[model samples]
Target: MTSLPVIDIDPFGTEVLTDPYPLERALLDAGPLSYLSAHGIYAVARYDAVYAALRNWQGFQSGAGVGLSNFRTEKPWRQLSIVVEADPPHHDAPRRVLANLLGPRAQRRLRAEWMAKAHKMVGKVLDGTPGSTVEFDAVTAIAEKFPPRAVGDALGLPEEGRENLLPFSDFLLNAFGPRNELVAAGAPHAKFLTTWVMEHCRRDALTEDGLGGQIWAAADRGEITHEQAPGVVRSLFAAGFNTTVHALAAVMHALVTHPEQWARLRAEPSLARIAFDEAVRWASPVQTFFRTAVGDVPVGDHVVPDGAKVLMFLGAANRDPRRWADPEKFDLSRDPSGHVGFGFGLHQCVGQNLARLEAECLITALAERVETLELAAPGERRLNNTLRAWHSIPVRARLA
Candidate 1:
């Protein structure tokens, strides 16, 4: 039997985070499974291996936590995510409640309103001299502004402290990796965001018409126990908020950087959702998630022992040459259906439909009004232990 290769490197180091594509390819080539000497965790970068591991929940358990820290032994810094950190019985109620509530069928009302909001917002930003280019940061103007207005409003959260959403999100995702400078950068706002999230996710703090209330209604209907209601709501808010924000930034950046892709989107406005999925494959937002091995789990020729932390590189797997043709290119022609950008199996992102909806509305709105999209300047990459984000993406847009 072949032994797993041992690599001495920090997967979360700043050098790797700034540009991971080269290393992503290297990891995939390192064989099916490898052990990270620096972090003492087993890693998988190939498409088939990562996908299969994600599907086998009984073998790679989420109940032990989906981060570098093992929940079986170490206490989690924050509340355990019911949606992503549990298995079978305890995971069923919340997953089903969110799956039914946030699916496409449930988003009919939100679809229309968000579409209109996207148009209005895009128009406001693209307001410039006719036939002249509009220069602005897409991340700041659109990505940062849209999710709070759309998803936050859908969740019936009070708009007063919505600005705290992004910073708070930084804390949540960064905590998934080792304690480092990235975690330190977001530490100052930890207390405030924690306090705010708890205060606002309560039943009284939400409006009756929003998704939050609907989760509560499920508990009222006895579909889920009343004790499980609050955690479900917190899970929804925690999972939904900033993920869409970074995903929006990734898609917009992809379109601007690839002029040909933007042209395709402009020609067929219906392709907005497809373009969004492609961008997710090209630039993964939630990079890595760790799962604990249940017992002896065997791959092609190696075995992961019980209680080992298996770090599945979602970003790397999405771009594996074995899985995608011209994997490095941000082409709209490729099918991104099986991509693990939003994860796979029962632990797949519960808010993914909502994310797709948000991106479709915004990208469709941009497609309608912008004749051309290009980068105004080089963008700044925001480094986080667990997230791929941009601090700014200056774009030059031509109004149609």
Candidate 2:
């Protein structure tokens, strides 16, 4: 083929991570597929192209690895996630097992229990004693705390080493991109955190009553190989934790920043799911996921060479005007159903139902109590190659 547009942006640089929307907007303005000269990888940011690429898995596959370092060549930093890093045949069984285990029906048991826990948790945080104000960092207070407790209890993971989940997940997502400072900083601790995660995934480490045990039960049913069971369990925190926690933080930030949306949610608590999805679309918390080109694939206008790494900017596409009107605005009234906040197609987030349920429960409790939520100070971003995290978001929630 001929040539495509070239953008000189370092897709993972500190500048873009601080405020990514402008560079992302330029990506949309640049044709469908543009070469990031800084990284030497082709980039896709348009909504239609990204939406199509996610579906045409055979053409742009994840099996080679969903990171910059292709598994076909380099060894992965950790054991490959059968669910996140595999293609059809190998992916088939693990996907089915996770689908069966993590889906809404399987997680239905946690609905009422988690909801009750959330009410108690929020009540404690913003104890409404007539006319007093309660303030806390939503990141540490709710987002970071909820997932591990809910998921850990569900998986029967011991309470002792649960702190490792966040850093472990950060390292894993960073490993997907270039070995930059972010990944390097976590290198020393990777061994310990990774060891903790692997240990927890074991059938022996899990309680027979939780979902981790359910994975072993799937192993027994011939759904997956016995050896593959723990890795599948690993997928729970690997794919599920960082994404859900960060998204929760992002959505809470959105609601606090957009008082109208919070008011609407307070008036009609059922819009919790809608607000969550909208925040995801607006924030694009889980930023980039890579797919290697299988062959000479036609992406947008250019034919990419065989084995070229195609970096899909999910954050950019979520805000593409072609897909969303006034995409920058976090509007609860907006329908964010097709948003790539949770990827797309068969590889779509398997734990989405769980994430949605978490948001619903937490938001329901907050809506019932908090009269007005306002930012106590400017929020800080926890920059990572793949995740958009909040280091701290100070907010004061007043109860009427």
Candidate 3:
């Protein structure tokens, strides 16, 4: 087989982390797979290649670690996630346990309650404003405020220390990148966040009817061991809130920037579900994940050698022209069902249904109450190695 093309780009640098589309395009244009000389890793940006890598997990495994530092070669900074960073047999039980715990029936039970909470939260925010046209930062006031409260309540976490969720999530996502300044900056608080998260995962800390309680119940049934319970609960905490928070912010940003789409949603509020999926496709929240090749894995014309770290660019793949028509345009009419924004294959985000439910409720609430959603000021992007998040989104919401 021919050698892989090498590109001298820093995939984890601040510039690419802040704005990655240009580098994404370059990676896609180079070949099916390109060696990033800066990081000495193979990267795939095209949709087909990314999808293939995710689907063929046996060839490209996650058990070694899904970050820059391979668990097989270097000691991981923390315990590896049983759900996300494991392979079959080892991955099967936890995946099955969490799948059942967070499945359709579970989300169905939470839907009505979450919807009501969404309306209540939106009402309180709007009521706090002076007049009919209310101005606020959508990121802080709406997106960031809603998910942690909603998901934290579901997980039965205490309200006092719930504020630590975002920072912990930021640190976790940053750790997926190279051990750069961002990860270094968060190292000081790692112990504090780890302790809090571990404490909340215990059976005694959870509400009887909450999702965490359900996972423990599964352990009691011998579906998973008592020892495995806390790890599974930690998986839920790690995966649940941050992705939804950023995704909601992304969808709102997409709608406000595209006034016509906002108008459509305002007219037909039922379009909220499709609008959310479209936004996920448009601005993928979780941008990149690394998979270690268990053996020689072939792309269109090259092979990723055994034990090599292969990076899949989910954000770039979501907008690949080869897969999407008018991919750059954020059109609500398009069917975005198959997008890899939440990932693809066996490890596809297990919490996607919850994220969808949260987005649907919040977006529907905004559509029902706001006649026009327009930006009040230039929005700011919060840079992280894995997440596409907004620092602030100042918006003027005209009441319906």
Candidate topping lDDT: 3
Question: What are the per-residue Cα lDDT tens digits for candidate 1 across 1-400?
Answer: 6667888878888888888777677789898899998989999889999999999999999999888898888877767877788899899988899888888776787889999999999989999766788998888899989988998889888879889878887788888888889888888888989889878777888888798888889989987887887788878667776788889999999998889888988888888889999989889998998999998898658988899999999999999989899898898888888899999999898788889999999998888788998887899988887789989999988888
**Model 1 spans > 4 angstroms off:** none
What lDDT does the true structure give each of the candidates? 0.87, 0.88, 0.89
For residues 109-191, what per-residue lDDT tens digits would candidate 2 score against the true structure?
Answer: 88998998888888888865856788999999999988988877887888888889989999999988899999999999999
Model 1: lDDT to the true structure: 0.87
Deviation from native of the Cα of residue 322 in model 2, angstroms: 0.8
Backbone clash pairs for candidate 3 read none
Assess candidate 1 and give its TM-score to the true structure. 0.98
* Residue ranges of candidate 3 with Cα displaced over 4 Å: 1-3, 128-131
lDDT of 3 by residue, 1-400 (tens): 6667888879889898888889998987887899999988999899999999899989999999888888888877777898899899889999998888788997988899999999998888776433389888899998998888888888877788888888888888889999899899999998899899889999998987888898899999999999999999999778887888899999999999999999988888889999999999999999999999988988889889999999999999999999999998899889998899988998999888889899899988887788887899999998888898889999988887
* Cα TM-score per model: 0.98, 0.98, 0.98
Residue-level lDDT for 125 in candidate 1: 93
Model 3 scores a C-alpha lDDT of 0.89
